[model samples]
Target: MKKILLTGATGYIGSHTALEFIEKGYEIVIVDNLYNSDISVLKNIEKITGVLPKFYEIDLKDKQNLEKVFKENKFDTVVHFAGLKAVGESCEKPFLYYKNNIIGSLNLFELMLKYSVKNIIFSSSATVYDSTAGKAPFFENNITGKTTNPYGTTKLVIENILRNLSNHKGLNVVNLRYFNPIGAHKSGFLGENPNNIPNNLLPYVMKVAIGELEVLKVFGGDYDTEDGTCKRDYIHVMDLADAHFKAFKFLQNSSKKIYEEINIGTGFATSVLEIIKMTNEVTGENLPYKITDRRAGDVDIVYCNADKAKKLFDWQAKLSVKEAVEDQYKFVINQNNKNK
Candidate 1:
């Protein structure tokens, strides 16, 4: 069995992807610092997969401790997901974002070069695309490098670095620019568990539904959409996990050193109000919400033209937004029960 190194493996998407890799019969190791995620997720993954993956509580920023892990174990590939990801927070502290996301990624890349582990699946974001450059749906071929916040800027910079570094004879890189990811695993054993107040829409909505938060603060409600709010292509977390699996298969069959970027999304735009309505439908209660000013660095409408992912990987989202809402609600209720 090929062993994989998963940075930030305890994170929301990383944890789900770890389960997927295990189910597909791959041996995996997890590395996370528990910055934004909890340590208990490791147990949850073991509960679902019956295999407690070897985990390292090391940060990517700590090069010495990180190097020790690489020296001791051989990794066939790496799925890089460690970083500070809040847009507003990134705007507040650009330097911190650059240091944590870019510098840490650079350290990891250098280590990869040293160890001769060339294959990688980078966790990129749609924010790297300039929404004002074109229409609603962004394609892989669309020009990037225009981002509104430091968090996205970090992703853009790392992507450039990866592209340039992949020019070497053996390095193979696949950068997956993800759209909004929501929902939880079907078992309710794993879900989006942010350490602090949630930043993403689905998590925030879940908090409101469970009475942890009084009202869901809708970011903007006067955008150019049908509901006068921002619209995004929110893909389910499990579907996002499946894309990583497909990417691994695609990378393994490559004959030459190649660097490819693909967008992973559902290719359908759902507005802010639509998400709230969906949440209400799942909970059977009209959750209280208040429309607020548009947050800085937020776009009006940004979804994906996911044809390239389908053409390349034979993968597209299988879960519906309604199902995502239901799964998210279930996870939130489970967590609430645990706290009580």
Candidate 2:
């Protein structure tokens, strides 16, 4: 079994991917600082997968402690997902995003080189694409580096660094550019539980349904789309997890060093209002919402052409947005029941 080191493995996508890897018979070690996630997620993962991954509470920016983890575990691949991800917060604190995301990634890459861990699967974002450069369906070969916020800038910079490393250092890198990921594990035992107030749409809508938040704050409602709202390609978190697993398999079977960027999405666009309506339909609650002004660094429409992922990894999203909404509501209701 190949040993995989998963950074931020207790977070939403990382935790789900850890379950996928463990169930696939891979030995997993998790490293997380618990900045935006909880430590209890490990217990939930064990409950679902029946295997508890070895975990270390170390920040990626702490090169010394991170190096200690590298020296302790001989990992075959690293799946990097540790970073601050809120776009509004990234704008509010650009320096924090830069220092945390870019510097931490550099440290991890340096350690991977030292440890001879040549394979990596990066958790990139669709935000790295230039939203104004083209239309809705963004392809892998589309123009990038015109990011709207500091969070996206960090992802683009890391991709460039990884590309350089792959060019000269013979590193195998796969940058999986992800669209909006919303949903939970089918077991309802694990899901996205942000530490603070939620930033994404589905989480906010779920909170409103559960009466944790009074009303959803819709970012914008006067865009050029049909409903005058921003449209995004929301993919199921589990499908996104599967993409990581497939990418790892692809790397393990590769004959030579390669750097590939692929988009993992459903290729179907849904609007902000449509998401709220779906949430209401799934939860059977009138999810009250108020549409405010347009947020800074937000585009009217941003979806992806996911054919590259399908062709390369033999992977495409199998879950529908309505199904994702249903799964998310189920998880939220289960959590509520557990608390009660």
Candidate 3:
């Protein structure tokens, strides 16, 4: 069995990917600091896959504890997902974002090199694209390094770092530039559980549907789209997990040193109003929302050309946005029942 190291494995996407790996019969070692996630997700994973992953509660920023994990386990690949991800928080505290995302990544990469783990799949964002270039269908070769926020800048810088490492140190890197990921595992055992107010779309919508929040604030409504609302390539989290697994397999079979950036998203774009409509249809609850002024740094449309992922890894999103909404609603209802 291939031994994989999943950073932030207790978090939303990480936990789901852990299930995918376990189901594929891979041994996974998880390392998370429990900052944005809870430790009980391990139980959820066990419930889903009937396998408990070896876990370490070590922050990637702590080089000492992180290196200890590397010393003990010989990993075949590393799927990196540990970082501060809030865009507004990143802007308010750029130092925190840089120190946590960039420094922590540096420590992890150094340890990977020391342990001779040459294969890695990095969790990147489509925000690395130059939104000023205007609109969706962003390809891998599109202009980058024109990010409008600190969160995106960190991802761009990290991609550059990975590119340099791949060129000089013979490291094989696959940068998965994800569009908006917004669903739950189909089992309803795992899903995004943000501690605070969600910064993303679907989570916020779920909150309103569950009566956690009063109303959803639609950010922009004057964009150059059919619905006048900004459109995004919202993909299911499970599909994103499959993309990671396929990318890792791609690296495992490659004979040459490689640094490839691939877009992982559904080629279709959905507007905010469309999401609200879907949520209403799924939960049978009329979601309350308000159209507001466009937030700063907001783009008109942000989707991707996922043909590269299909051509390279034979991966495309199989689940639709409607299906994602249904699964996410199921997860919320399951969690509510559990808490009650």
lDDT of each: 0.91, 0.92, 0.92
What's the distance in Å from true for residue 187, model 2? 1.0
The residue-by-residue lDDT of candidate 1 on 1-340, one tens digit each, is 7899999989999999999999999999898999999999999999999999999999899999999989988999999999999988898899999999998998899999999898999999998888789797889888788788899999999998999898854579999999999999988889999897788988988888888789988888888889888889999999999999999999988776779899999998998899999988888899999999987666788889898889888999999988999998888888888889
Instruction: TM-score for candidate 1, please give it.
Output: 0.98
Candidate 2: 10-residue stretch with minimal lDDT: 278-287
Candidate 3's C-alpha lDDT? 0.92
What alpha-carbon RMSD in Å does predicted model 2 have with respect to the real structure? 1.1
Q: Is candidate 1 or candidate 2 better by lDDT?
A: 2
| Most accurate candidate by TM-score | 3
The residue ranges of model 1 lying beyond 4 angstroms of the native Cα positions read: none
